[model samples]
Every structure is written in C-alpha cells, then in structure tokens.
Target: MAEFLQRVQSVVWNRKLIRTAKGHYLGLGPEKTEVGDGTDGKPVYTLVGEAYVHGKMDGEAIDFQVENQILVEKFELE
Candidate 1:
C-alpha cells in the first residue's frame, strides 16, 4: 500500500492532475508541515497536503470536496 501511495504521490507531484479509472480526477493542493509527536513520544515533523477531486458532470467539470477517504482509496491508475 505504501508503494502504491508512493506511485500516486510521484504521479501527482507538483499538483499535476491525474485521471482515475472511475472517471474522477486527483491532484495535490499544497505542501503543509506540522509538528506532532510520533510513536516514540518524540516530536515528529509531518508533511501534509490536501487532495482534491473533480467529477465529470454532463461532460463538464464539477469540483467535489472529498469528505470520504474511500473515494481516493478506490482510485486505480490505468
């Protein structure tokens, strides 16, 4: 799963849009860094970003705010 995430990350790097099998699109938003504690009880730095989705609506693009992670989990690159 980590490998798949890495692949997806590489493909979507620099906020490039990628189309999925389900006719939806995926792209990175922006880079975000946060400080948090890790499993070792030490401060851990985390890099995070928002993933966006756009669904096709009657051949038009409709932006969707992803409230469920399952939508992204089902993405399969062909």
Candidate 2:
C-alpha cells in the first residue's frame, strides 16, 4: 500500500471510520444527497471525497447484501 501511495500525486490521509450494513469498516469522507435524476430511480449520493472501504472495496458489498437479503437503503446527510 505504501508503494501504491508513493506513485500517486496529492494524497491526503484522513481517518473517518464508517460502518456498513454488515459491520464492515470504511475509511471515507461523508456523502451528501442532492435532488437529481438520471440514476435509473436509484437514489444518487454525492460523494464528498475518496473512500477506502476494507473487504467491501471490491464487489463484496453486493454479494453480502444478496446473500443476506439486505435491502438497499439511503440516508439524507445533515
């Protein structure tokens, strides 16, 4: 991971631990939702910045949700 960081330009390390539905840890900035369309009816969330979600960084979230029959949810950030 250190080598990968070194190759990138303008990187900032910030720790804001967020827990997903399955209790997975996510290191990311807060997101906001604004009224918009073109999301195919799926609510669009405007990401404030970058994210580094462990385990679920790939397609694990989708698989987890599918296996556990978890429904998609959205929260309006204040």
Candidate 3:
C-alpha cells in the first residue's frame, strides 16, 4: 500500500492545473501522500497542499487537501 501510494503521489505531483477564475487557483504541495481506511472499509489516500488566491480575488492562502483511493474485496500483492 505504501508503494502504491508513493507511485500515485509522484504522478499527481508532476501534474499541474491550468484553468482559473478571477486569478484564483489551487496549487498542490510540498507534502507527499499517505494511506488510511475509508468509511466503507476501503483504503483512502490523501494529498495535501496550499490553496492560493491571487491579487485580492479572495482570502489568503490556505491548506488544500484531497484524496485518491480504491476499494477492494481482497488485498493482493504482485
């Protein structure tokens, strides 16, 4: 699971967001990803970063967090 999360985080960090509204956009982090359990007994992965609002378009910069995970009936390793 740790290895899987690392791979996923690497892919996400290499990507960037381009669309914008009023100069406000989300910027992903200096932080990495981790794994946990979800509400339905499934694996839940989380990624956290900074949220930026530019030029008085909104409030100050703040923490931005998101998750990516999968549910499985059985855990397997290749």
- lDDT tens digits, residues 1-78, model 1? 999999987866666343444545543344442222123453443435554545444434322434332243233333
In order, the Cα lDDT scores of the candidates are 0.46, 0.57, 0.40
Clashes of each: 0, 0, 0
- lDDT of prediction 3: 0.40
Q: What tens-digit string does per-residue lDDT give for candidate 3 at 1-78?
A: 999999987756644443243335443323332222123454553435443223323423212211223333455444
What does candidate 3 score in Cα RMSD to the true structure? 15.4
Candidate 3 segments whose C-alpha is farther than 4 A from its true place: 18-78
Worst 10 residues of 3 by lDDT: 59-68
Give the higher-TM-score candidate: 1 or 3: 1
Top candidate (lDDT): 2
Q: Which stretches of model 1 miss by more than 4 angstroms?
A: 16-53, 62-78
In order of lDDT, best first, we have: 2, 1, 3
Q: Which ten residues in a row have the lowest lDDT in candidate 2?
A: 29-38
Better of 1 and 2 by lDDT: 2
Candidate 2: regions farther than 4 A off:
1-5, 13-26, 30-47, 73-78
